[model samples]
Target: MGVQLKSSSLSPTVDHILDSRRHNSCLTLDAVPKFACRVKYLNLLLLSAMPGCCFCEGMALSRLLLLVLVAELAAASSDVGFVFDGFTGEANLSLNGYAEVTSEGLLKLTNFTPEMTGHAFYPSPINFKNATDGRPISFSTTFVFAIVPVYPNMSGHGIAFALAPSKELPGSMPSQYLGLFSKSDNGQASNHVVAVELDTVKSVDFADINANHVGIDVNDLKSVNASPVAYFDSREGVLKSLQLISGEPMQVWVDYDGGEMKLGVMVAPLNKPKPQVPLVSFTINLSSIVLDEMYVGMSAATGAATGCHYILGWSFGLNRDAPPLDLSKLPKLPRQGSPTKRSTEVLAIELTLAAIILLLISTAAVILIIRRRKKFAEMHEDWELEYGPHRFSYKDLYRATKGFDEQNLLGVGGFGRVYKGVLPTSKMEIAVKKISHDSKQGMREFISEIVSMGRLRHRNLVQLLGYCRRQGELLLVYDYITNGSLDR
Candidate 1:
């Protein structure tokens, strides 16, 4: 009834409409002409069969993917830049400013004129420019000051960084505004102040700054109760002085990220790129400051007493914040009794001398042993001749001594065992000594005793009546001593 068409073209149109309806089920198939429906349907089937042909769906999906990608990119960028606070690289700041105090007045800067009054005012402040784009950065400052002739009972003043509303740092403000002037003279007038004080003069037990000491104050410029962080001499005990000494340059750095701030201070030798002194690093929350840009510089003032302070140089970085200090760059230390070349040489000499001494000792021992063997051999030969072999047969001695009966034993000596015996031929009582086969000193001692006694024939001396030498066995016959031995 509605004019149906069944051509091949209409088949495609119909397929198109059908496919569209399947994709979006609310599509109105009735709204399409019959012929166009078939064509639309065919087109839809072809498009559906294709790899990527969903127009509206693809557009919507692409948009969602793009949003996700954008979010990921933003997150990545936020983490891509400088991430830490403190002096990272070789960047540093130097101190070369002037500070003076007088008895009746202090130096003041106003109207292009300099005047001296009892009131102390910083003449020049060390200027530190942030060469970086206007990004909040972290910064720290440290300086050395030496009090002349060191005041014993006086409490010292404080130090400050003046980011004043204006560049013209005038002398009239109270110490509370900027600790450039004495806080004792004026009570907390300057609320826009940040100060770090080294209050050595306030504490009676505090050590002198001139004697390798320093104090650090943060945020409380005028209050005496502001406890300070302190630094003291290293083991070397070298006092740091602020009068532009060769090694007194103070190193300061400011590091800033979007939401973080850090400051660091280091003491370095003049003309050196590396800092050789102790370093202090700190962080501050910068969310409260209204300004995104700031000027960094330092100011100091001496009291009625005479003193001096100095600054060297300053540097800054932008967009890129400072990373944490490597700290490993500080210095290489020495160890006790390190094996230096000199020490090695000394040891070598000592070893050589010791080796020579040992060689001499070993040679002496060998020679002594050789000579002893020769002497022993000579004595043994002489003993062989004098005592004669077959002096006493084994059977004869055994029978005479009653087979070495214990009761027949006369005594003992270091050389051998002695026993009473009666010689069969001479019909005389004699002492017989039987040498032990295994004694370490047996051969030499036996030979010596035999040879010595064999040549002697005295009434007082024991007679070497005769001896037997056979098969590593020895027997000695001597005139008997009735009164025991000489020791007894």
Candidate 2:
């Protein structure tokens, strides 16, 4: 029988298409990388023939690339497990019934209500990979889950990780049945469902040893093998039973080999090195339950008293040769009282208002800069008009200094050197102090002399004559002081 992998976005019905040929189905989460698929070539060939179904690029492009990895399942062993990204959201799973992963990260299989039933299935099916002739294949599965009470009160019913003949759990009901079988199929011999039950409440409807126990169900409510869920503490050398509705996530490890199954429960505190001693060990022929390839997932329900059931994290491996699971690698537990969808709305409004305030501040800064530039230009225009007659042309000064010849230079001081030169237009002898271009003090002194001396009238002090500007040099001129201080 050829298994053609299908592309159904989030449909467990990807297995539903084993009955059809040349059909389309979406890929599974981990199944995207395995199985040397010849079916991919077939899918491409079929799409080429049908012009109406051209896959275009857009949001669907990413789906197409992932879907590209879909291929036929080979006749080989199947090993499926979950990563940290497994319980991210509803986006990562193919949920059914009322089952969903809440935004707070809880994988709620069924809400708390009377007669509520929910079934969640992983998108892919597990193959025992032993032989098709009904040979018992040994496998192991580790599950960390919780059964919460409806506040101040515990609930009836429980949850189970099931290996079913098909994806459908037909005739399933709530309570003692645990939503795996119905009243009609309760005691029936032909039911191919093998469930490992974590039951909380006792039921008159079924033979339950206690309110809290782990059971192995084969087509019936009566457990073929059962044990009260307990942890064996090595330090104290005692086995302790746990309250199933304690709200803390409990870890259960199951390993089956050599016609015998072993289960370990760690309820108090789970640490490195799995509990060595098995809490429950029983021998049964899983070969009898194996009628076909099984779909492995969790099923939960509520009846009478209801509590929120969660399948936080789970992993499975086939055969004894596979590597042991590192519980640390499993996805994180759902956080308690995390922000819900309603809180996200409030956050969105706050973000929008902050963005508007930032935009207003940026606009005001740009306007202020432009206004300051305009005011500075108006002040410079007034300064030029007031000092018009006193400022000599740069050309007249350059000619009078003869490109600042050496003989015309008289003396040098902190600011610059004084040069004696005669103006060509009026034959007026002038002493010029050429301020250094890069000197900060020289520029300050030049501005101080202009603003202070130009407005002052003095007879004893040297008269302020004029000034000139070259490329960037500040040239200051004053009546030559010769007879009073120098030997002329």
Candidate 3:
């Protein structure tokens, strides 16, 4: 029976050739070569109709023709590969998890949703080994992709271009595994998997080199060869770094030479020519890891943080260089809605300014407290140390007497004004005498007599509690006698 090819963009002439069942006879293997000749003739007609069709690039038409030719050869020979500039007419891709083909023909592997996994693969398996020796065959692939993080410069996990024995990796995990392997299956030789990882997070369990790196993984996430995300500048003769989460489109090229057992990976910004130097190069024998038939695809995963991984174009060829992607024909990336790095810098500046203002306010409050304490400072002398038990702080006295306001005055005698007061700590009522400044001449003798009298204790006489002296004031504390002080 003839293999049916379903494509919406194919001309009626090509469609008739692909769907031979409509002719009431099954096409044999011999007809495939003859069908290829018809396809080449249809390509000339398709090229002439390109101006009338939606596709503006003539190169895109050639790429489509090449993909159909390769798909035919895949049936008869081991050289199997295909190309897709966009997913508009693609119907044979196998999608799982969050993977979807967008209305704009973009193959979105993962979205902003957290803790998700997605996979997109060619529907059929490809021959990866030689029948004679069972040795691995050479292959090349190139893809254009972009990562749009939910936050600038931050994304959870990353994406990987993988080749595995099965398209659906049962029991696989998301996040650090890139949806290819689970914790139990990782690093097992039976997996028979090879992948190129574009990691954005540093996973210690996997011994990742850094947060941003490209690694070549074989049956395990622990890469045998890895490098920081960077590209060589041929003109500058230096290696320049690239940010994978910059929300810009980038191209990656992977090539494996079965003869030399060498694998090379290169990366660069979209529309830029491939770098002369490869980002990661290593010697690896794939014959033991690659199965006879395997599926080729891309897988991605998200952790606590997430970014949308999009594939704009892809091409693969066995025993030949994969066709270059037509950047002009790829879908445009969605404009980033998340805040940029500039906004984060602005927030940092605002926080710093707020901290400075808070510090200034705290310093001013401390200075005000110090000034107020000095206003109520008491005079101290060595002799007063012996009367420490009988002395009261000026601050306490000032607060107790309410600054000696006229309302608290009990009487004005010849010595000074007697004010009704209370002890702050003891909450005991007392009487305070503020001696006139002119009484300073005999203040020492008077204070001595008062101290001596304080030693006297009688129920009928008011008791002396304590005393406080300021630079220009002498204050005496006496026990309070209620009911108008017996004279009022």
Top lDDT model: 3
Extract clashing residue pairs from model 3: none
TM-score of 2: 0.51
lDDT for every model?
Answer: 0.40, 0.62, 0.78
**lDDT minimum window of 10 residues, candidate 2:** 1-10
Error of 2 at 153 (Å): 5.0
TM, every model: 0.29, 0.51, 0.64
lDDT tens readout by residue for model 2, 43-76: 4433433222333334355345435534223333
Give the per-residue lDDT of model 3 (tens digit) for 357-437: 999999999988888878787778776777788888888878788988789889888777889888789898888888756
Cand. 1 TM to true fold: 0.29
What are the clash counts of all predictions, listed in order?
Answer: 40, 6, 0
Question: Could you tell which candidate, 2 or 3, scores higher by TM-score?
Answer: 3
- Tens digits of lDDT, candidate 1, 279-361: 44445443343132233445544444322222222222233433333332322111211323334567789999999999999
Residue 394 miss distance in model 2 (angstroms): 99
Full ranking by TM-score: 3, 2, 1
Whole-model lDDT, candidate 3? 0.78
